[model samples]
Target: MATYGDLRWGVHLMKRILFLMSDTGGGHRSAAEAISDALKIRYGEANMQIELVDVFRACHWPLNKMPEFYPWIVNKSARAWGWGYRLANMRPIYSLNKRMIYYGNRQRLHNIIQNHAADVVISVHSVITPPMMYAYQSLSQRPPFITVVTDLVSTPRYWYDPRVDFTFLPTQKAYERGLRRGLEPERMRVVGLPVHPRFSALRERATVRAEHGWDDGLPVVMMVAGMDGMGRLYHTARAIDAQNLNCRLAIITGKNAALKARLEAQTWNQPTDVYGFVRDMADKMTAADMLVTKAGPATISEAFIAGLPVILSDRIPGQEDGNVTHVVENGAGVYAPTPAQVAETVAAWLADDGAQLRQRKANARRLANPSAVWQVADAIWEYAHAAYIPAPKKSSRSARYRILKPEATPQR
Candidate 1:
């Protein structure tokens, strides 16, 4: 059993961070990876150790299968998914499930936290927070726990837990939502969503387009269906092509092999490019004029970072609905739920030498927070070092703080 007092005063120890997340959506894992990347940039690999644990996978049978159910509900059982979301939105329902899941996987989760010996624990997914908190009860020396909400504005009530040391919110709406959920102002920060640091780098549109062998002069409309490619991608692309607009199409059919084959086989009316899974999304996004995609929080945030406007084609009923409103209300993009509307909006944006498109791009840039990853990482470091470690005590003789000698500190 150790506490902050166990550490020798004035000694800077290597910080070990454990990030709790699940694969329910790629955004949760992406948020964790973004913070990891920022930590690498800020502290270098030698000084920081980061471990990402899929909390759902670490849990018991039915509970562990929760992540797998996300795609099935969003794609196959949309109505049922909406119903479930509404049911779970109630605090009582969420608490019941949270308690069940926590008890069901208590031992395994406790072992994870104890084994990791983490200096700081960050929960990126809402479902993991309760379980992680439950595990913390078993430890005598508990680390600082942080919750970084992956959802944009429409976060579920289950996401907020007063036990957490701090909560990082992505939007002002999310911050306001936290307040309503009884979060103290001191316990939350309105830091924007975390994207890869590469998105923060300046890139020339023409240069990126040329590097990818895309047409530099023509407007490029990029459509992405997230990692699952679970949207009306084919119909939207078809509708856009039917309009005979003077724009090129680039489709990212993520892990959807059938969709990829079908799209590649068809003869498009405009110059088009098809990619299966792209690692360099930042470069691709930078080259594009506008993005046509589902209202995923990560995609929207990435688009903002790239200074590209969006055309939202679909949104999962409960959680993703706010993403659409955020984009449209902020003047960063338009919400076109159907293929026809998508085509019409694209046509209008491309009309009159892309006057409206340029305006949206400016707005997107205004909303972009590419440096958010660094901000979050720095905040984590500050909190962990300041509150989780013992401060130097002053000596009466000199009235100066004591400093530890190099040889006096022991390494783990």
Candidate 2:
């Protein structure tokens, strides 16, 4: 048995971790970075080497363009996206998709694993998980592999693979979904979605407001759609502004320069601040009394940590559908799809000196797992330490290039 002291001393041995993800959305990369940061925090940076690879970007032609095409796919028609999502979740279609992915990208994926030579591999994206696992199965000496489901509730079927050494679920709902999809109970853990550690270290609301030059006297309502500013943010802002509410507005038009410019060009009824993509979201959330945004898992998790009640203005179809229910049902927030509904929800929360808003804030805080990042880091570290083994001596060039046998291929 490896003693605790022995493991501590082994810290000098520099463990390598490979995080496999895609830029399909910001959440996957953000989750990878949060976990990577957590690992560095737990075991000093020198003790570990972490690399994030956009697996889809490294794949063959059409597959490689997935990251680039994702936004268009969602933006073009959410109903179409939802249809495809549901279609792919069918048992036969899912199996066929896995086979096609394995056959198409096995060699490239195998090359990725060989080149990276990691002690542990983690997948944060649903689309790449199955194919990556298939490639890992071909290796004679495979390390531990983990799947951290970034979706809060309605996780896609592609996210679950029984062969994975471990699966980290963001919520109990997600874990149940995995169980229904055949993931062993013991192999899956319901750890909350990992957000930046900064969210956990929120400062006093008034202090943060003071630092940001926001008025402490007025209630702050922060509105954000996403990094891409995908939803009806401008209209929603207009609706809220038209309400003539006493609260101040902090609108974050993230990476949407046009939207920011447009919002800035306008005259408002209230003390409103318009900002572009900001790095200090944690600070902004801390300063705000409430958050109005879409149902993105990462944003929701961050809001939970900040204890800010969310007023969901929009959500992507399929995967994000359940997130709305999770928030509203948990009493952390309400799902108001239309701009008028969002305005109404906001106005209602602001009533009675924000009595309802405070209750929602308490609920959000109760659902938060502020230490989730650290917990996930600790689990991954344990897996890495346990799975670490000395690399075998180099084989002949011909032997190294040998393909996986049919008998060794992974099954559905």
Candidate 3:
């Protein structure tokens, strides 16, 4: 019943939203932008303001591998480091990762809380939540903090504490995972993934095609590599091209100069587009018939709402693999292991719209919950009212954190 303007906390003036993000993988930051855009569009600029920031860019990141450009690193040290990251993601390392992330960013985050006083604070990164919550306890004036998880696979690391006012989930499986983890069911909301509002317009396929100057019959295939402007694009493109599939290809080769150069080198007679880093992804999603990429939760969720069938491919190990599993198991995308297989599936979809595409599209519709933004905005409004006191009582310190395991557990 809480509409956008219905706030007892005088938040009908819900003036601003601070979207905290990082430059880690493009998915996290991109998810933040998507939600903020939704708030601005639904609430109107006069009623709301949105600001996006990169916590990592504020300081700069030391080189991290695999998920953050470590394809070669995963190849080089297959056993030592990559295995460690994957294995740690299991139930054992959850508490240890939680502590390391908390104390590391504790002070700097305290400053962020002191400086920006929005009605609500939202984070796309799970790692940042523990630290932010620790700092939130110190401020005399703090806003409600919500963690919008960009990953579909819920791990113990993500459900760190009960301090978060709400945790937004991407899938039914993730919601169930949260319930199993003892997260407060009232505070846990399954709003699907926060997708850009542009994807929510629900335009007819013919209407979308006319805007792009494409024939109504031609299937539009959009290829995206997160915001880094990347993913096994060349090979993926080559695989698609080899089929001479009847679909038009729109390749989004995000900021990677080498990837862009390689894509430019290829010659194709079919209708094709090769661009680097587009500011309006919702427009791109609106214009496409299908999405092809590694199954980042943000991209998958966006595609799900737009009713675009997805070809899930090119995943890194650990969380990305988990996300892809959720998408496939939920029937949101076709599980394609190779570029050729992806092309074959695309051909089947185009050959008979009733074939694979039809089923996947149904799955996507079943999977999407477009109301997540309003839910988040609603929670933020609540945060404004509840955050009248800046700090938690010291006597209640133990209430802030949950001990996942015993103290004698070994640290890696």
Candidate 4:
């Protein structure tokens, strides 16, 4: 009911902004938390309110309710989200999904909007976008529905309607892709990725390492790769020990207790620390000499935002190619194609020419738009209030990515 015109008087401490995130990837939750953190630091507790609802849990949707129903399909497919990442970025696949998902998620998004009474709603995942867009139809007054692309590349399916107030992108390519998808250039903001501001500030590496009880002078190699908690741990550990590299390694085995136990059993002569899951990634990043990670858009972007050099171990396919390009082109990181090659590259990176480090930092800084939250939050507020909310804009930046329609998939 109230539009930007109504907000001319400005908002007070009571105004509320709600964020919607998924449990699927650490990136989505991390992005939402980072924004919330920034808002709190800027406005303090009373001035801002944030609730991140997992849509699956918020509503007993069948597809979401029984994770076991399609266990093999679901888990395998999710792990294959990288293919989706690529498919979502490439061709007509990207464009069509935008419209399809937009319609499918309608009811759920409506319920979420109505229940939360959010002045503005932010979606960190694309699956929620379509539903959120349609949910607007059921409201007496819909809130501004904001979609933040949590990957290094822009998602075509996520940009179907220009009605969205703003689409936040991590890379220039993504911003351009959004424009090609029929978004107005003005509506596209090249705010790299939303990372905790703590990462933006330079932390004293020695202090962070000391607090973690790491050796005083060794190079700290932090692997940001996903853990299987199975055989992979020993292989990676053995590789490290055999290399006889002079570095302290820290491996984050996220949600993998088995891998943790297995790794603990190994008496690695090389100094190392293994963590299950860590909230203080920024600190760990600061303490590390160079990061070894998987090429997931969010992690890559976070590492980029932190200004730490990277060596991406596993490159998830599809859009991750673009994600990898962004980092490598900028000189902030290197992609190690072979598992064994990792140690050698680490050696080279430790002894890199001066300009390379400077360039990497420059590229990382260029990608980071640290003030993204204020801009995004403000845009959502403005759009949600308008009596006439626009339809989602087609992204123009996505023209190069338009793929053949699903109808054209060749029949075997």
Window of ten residues with lowest summed lDDT in model 3: 403-412
Per-candidate Cα lDDT values, in order, are 0.83, 0.85, 0.67, 0.63
lDDT of 4 by residue, 54-173 (tens): 775554455365223322333356457655466665657755755565455545544565456555678887666765665564443355667788877635555435767777877677
For residues 1-412, write the lDDT of model 2, one tens digit per residue. 1111112225244577789999987899999999998899878887877889999888888989998787778777878988888899888999999889878987788778766766678999987899887776655556788999998998988999988889999999899988899999999998899988887788887888888889558899999988888888999999999999998999998889999999999999989999999989999999898999999999999999999999999888887999999999999999998999999998999999889999999999999998888888999898877643233333453245333322422221
How many backbone clashes are present in model 1? 0
The root-mean-square deviation over C-alpha atoms between each candidate and the true structure, in angstroms, is: 7.0, 6.0, 8.2, 9.9
Candidate closer to the true structure by lDDT (higher is better), 1 or 2: 2
TM-score for predicted model 4 compared with the true structure: 0.79
Best by TM-score: 2
* Candidate 2 lDDT: 0.85
Which ranking of candidates, highest TM-score first? Answer: 2, 1, 3, 4
Worst 10 residues of 2 by lDDT: 1-10
Q: Compare the candidates by lDDT and give the number of the best one.
A: 2
- Candidate 1, residues 1-412: lDDT per residue as tens digits? 2222333323557666788988987899889998998888887776766888888887889768878888888998777887888798798888898888877877787667555656778899987887677556444335688898889878988778887889999999889888999999999998899898889885787888899888558889999999878878999999999999888999999989999999999998889999998889999999999999999999999999898999999998887889988999999998898999999999999998889999999999999888888888998777555434332232353122122223433443
Number of clashing residue pairs in every model? 0, 0, 3, 39
Task: Compose the digit string of candidate 3's lDDT tens values, residues 1-412.
Answer: 1122322223344454677776667777667766666666655656655666555444323412224544444434534544666665566576676556556655455445444545567888765666567666654435567888777774436544577777888767777787777788998877767766666666666665676676656678899877665456778888888888777898988777778887888898578878888776766777787899877777787787777778986665565667777777887787786878887877777886457777787788787777776676666655644524345654554343321212322221
Q: Which stretches of candidate 2 lie over 4 Å from their true place?
A: 1-11, 388-412
